[model samples]
Target: MKSLLDLLKTKGPRDAREGAESNLFTTAFASKLAQGQSAVPWEARAVEVAATRLPKSRGTRLLQSVWAQDPYMSHLSSDRVDRMQRFFAFATISPNRDLIRQDEYGSFMIVLLSGTIGVDRRQPWGEHLRLAETRPGDILGEMSLLDSGIRFSTCTTLTDCEVAVLSAEAMDEMMEHDAPLAASLVALLARKLSLRLRVVSSRLSDNPHG
Candidate 1:
């Protein structure tokens, strides 16, 4: 049987023009999601963060400490963490914002530096099913981030949130410039994803109603 990494890695731009294709994907993806498509709407109201860029040197050690404790993230050396900090864009998002909306096509994933997010699914008959709530050091939308797939659940910030966003463009650049670090990152993300899926499977198997 194919391992989970093999299954997840079977995703990427379907064409040779990596830059053009990723740009087109993001532009169209954002435009479509803006025109009234969200698991919950935040973009249509023009709440999009106007600040597009952030300095890399801010709050380094605090985030570094948190990452060092994560089982998968611990594999990254301090140098790799420096590389990651330089690569990712940091943002402070306010409460009640949707970091990810179900079924929207987006090219980035969020790493929470602080605050809480609720991950939930909207059922067919109009009820919201809470899957999990995330905290500091947690990652949101990474499955889609890795595979460029549609988001399976909506992730909404429940408090003022600080995040590091890793974009597809950044990922591609990383892969080109630092192949080993990129491989480590992909492996790290894959292991985290695989662990989550295993926990979910275990829960479902244990549930009498499931």
Candidate 2:
């Protein structure tokens, strides 16, 4: 399926910004989830194994302390930290576990409060391409989190890692309970996706093979 970004480029998919699951997650990926991980809901699947839930107060403090040093993270004001805390659940994952897998359905996004995550994609010709290594404050599964599209790459915990998760259910609650914060969050995600599309376009323009 074409990404919401792709649709946007052609002046379509107006609902993408509002977290629409219309054609994206409700398609094949959702079926796959029902067939395989049917016993557990989407959010439970994201927690993985060995991920201990951290207390809210400690988690908020930690999340506020290390927004992952990513300058893009600064798009969110630090003053909003306290309010944002309740919407997120903090967990620590043991190493060698896939936080998220390529081409799989995901209903949430994670902020890396601490620890390393290796982001990779499995190419059609059997190559495992290492896309990036996540740092503190890095966000994973955000694209899927926003659009409910299947993940484009796999994100694996390379070491013990602490993360803050924002699930779809939580987002819904936030929208109902705190509309302003929810709008701001959606705007932030839209901006981030736009920037990524621009970067990809520039790279494709530069690629000699293309």
Candidate 3:
């Protein structure tokens, strides 16, 4: 199988790169999932391992701590926790960079391990309306993963930030093979959605004239 980097190089045009890479990765990842192997590729693992040999980043350590205490992850067994950790790939975004853009199609969710991000909605006039600022331990893109739709908001880093990303294919494979994990995930997502709705309701109530 071709490495993801190799596949990415074959895709033409800088503007199309991100989409092409995402599609290629998802297809290859889904194929591995179908074979009952871990969704993360060996090449990806090798890269992560190498990166971690240097002193681990503060964000990485923070993410490890969150996995131990966050309600969304705390219920997992040791083995499941280990497996879940492996499924994620670490990412860092520079300050002012958009982590996700509104209307972009995505098949992955992100856990904000460190720093903050601003979630903004693009108005018809192209001005951005700030919706929320996400802090560490928050999860973004769950709605997209659940519905397979375009991103609803643009998530941009307020400062340098680190995140752990879990692809939809990996999540689906985990749900298919582990009922308990699936239940936990669904419950967590439901709770997150409920919280978000409450916030929206409160905002609407305050802006009744709009």
Candidate 4:
């Protein structure tokens, strides 16, 4: 993926005189930042800190898998990825007994870099519904972040872990800059949903009430 700084210098332009196609993508992408212009002080601060500390590309397999299967990855030219990479937020979570639910953090994607996490999809009747055990190379919280929808499950750490977080605003800014990336992201969203559907289908087939 491209770093955020690279996107600014290479993808961003100084004026509208740049060719219409180039300008179009750049302009659209820039609009995201402008649209959030009225952000509160804390929000702006969060953006700044996240942007500045966003991880630099390390050519890891997990990243490579995401780029390969994620529809949005293809839309982003290497130049764009280099630029977008800059906005990534890095986080580390140690193994704990507590559970993390969607209501706590708004929306974000957690990429497991190490260890594992247990996902429990809550039932309508207020009961724990075991989902999947996520490990390194797995992506958690993507469903909510991708669609700007509510989180579907609760995640709990099983071991010390590190993860990459991509928030909604950051995602919006990245998409605004590149049309292809937006299209790709939508595709990725579809793929993920389809996979989940298949899993659900298999479960239903095996056990009618499940």
Candidate 5:
């Protein structure tokens, strides 16, 4: 599968942006996976067992809130909703701890349930470029699922953070059996990309001289 970056490089900026916008809600990639095409190779890393689990009631409430706010989960059937609620594992990260490292292969993405995270890029000289600050309800590490399974930037918790971790394997399994679930995942990723594009546009507009 071609990475979005690779596809963008083949077109002019305007055309690339247009192409991305047009492809946002398409599930062609997921469809290909369903047909038994080669899956993107994600590097396996030791999984960290969650040290804590939310009480069932509290966890269900949290999942309900996420479903209400997230556009991607808006139209899901009750069965899919129940499945998602059970699929995630809660995780907590200490302040200044890295949640994701640039260039590392990742098999899971995180949905911030609370607190903030700083997204950064390492410069060639080893300095960090702070890209954005992500807050509650934001999704992180999704690029790993869509592209090469490699993370493009580092993410660190700015404050102690609580996140819901969803693995790619679980998602693949859901996609293979549930078409609605697959479409919802694609929509969620599309929404994340759209938000990022808007941010980039805003930055460019504010710094027209650059």
Candidate 6:
């Protein structure tokens, strides 16, 4: 089970981007700018144009914010913060309703930036069972990112929503460059996972059927 970084490294340089599970930048309008495609979505077009002007440091900042907000970030040293500031890439996703499905590759760390999303498990009886509502600042998709596992459940937006995505490679880079930050991040991830497990356990105790 190779991590996303290992998978990316194995690709030919030209094919790196193509290997991504989702085109975080591909919006409705990028086709219009293509050689023969028409009517590219403006939002997609804007991301393309913005990509050229934004500096790498700015991208790093966006990712740092996600890391800092994690309860685990409290353990990080200032030096680690500086190192994190040095590396990392950021991308945003604004998916339409029910756009992302279950059992997909859990490739990135997603921070809910806005709106609401429902986390649910499909059951033998029906779908939409064991649902949890998530709001801004909530971190999702981490279970799979920290471990090479498929998505544990489905996440569907209740309204148009935004998510900040940071690749595993970027996270690995942060760890290599800043030991404290890496430790802090791992601890943060652990804490979040532990909390989530407790929540699940409590629910099960209340109603094992769930």
Over 4 Å off, model 4: 1-62, 65-83, 97-105, 204-210
Error of 4 at 92 (Å): 1.2
**Mind giving the per-residue lDDT tens digits that candidate 1 earns over 119-173?**
8876666666677888778877777766556787888888877777777667766
Please state every model's RMSD to the true fold in angstroms.
Answer: 5.7, 6.6, 12.1, 8.5, 10.1, 9.6
lDDT over C-alpha atoms for residue 62 of model 4:
40
Candidate 3 Cα misplacement greater than 4 A, ranges: 1-61, 67-79, 125-127, 204-209
Candidate with the larger TM-score of 5 and 6:
5
Candidate 2 C-alpha lDDT tens digits along 1-210? 235444333333233344343333334345557577432233565454658877887788777777534455555577776788888988888888887888767777888887899988776767676667878877777777666666888889999998898876676566555556665666666776777668645754564443
Give candidate 6's error at residue 120 in angstroms: 1.4
TM-score comparison, 1 vs 6, better candidate: 1
Q: Give the winner by TM-score: 1 or 4.
A: 1
Q: What are the TM-scores, per candidate, against the unseen true structure?
A: 0.74, 0.74, 0.64, 0.59, 0.65, 0.58
Worst 10 residues of 6 by lDDT: 20-29
True lDDT of residue 6, candidate 5? 38
Off by over 4 Å in 5: 1-51, 55-57, 70-80, 201-210
Q: What digit string (tens of lDDT, one per residue) describes model 4 on residues 1-210?
A: 134323333443232334433333333333444665221222342353332232444524345545555454455456555555554565555565333463333345656666688877656556566677875656666665543444566777887665665665565555445535544554555566678769856754564335
Model 1, poorest ten-residue lDDT window?
38-47
* Best candidate according to lDDT: 2
lDDT of prediction 4: 0.52
Per-candidate total of colliding backbone pairs: 0, 3, 0, 15, 0, 3
Tens-digit per-residue lDDT, 1-210, candidate 5? 234433333433223244323343224344445666533322222133222454545555565666667666556555666666665666565677777778766566777777899998766666666778987778887766655345778888898777776666655444444445555666657676778868856764565343
Model 5 poorest ten-residue lDDT run:
41-50
Full-model lDDT, candidate 1: 0.67
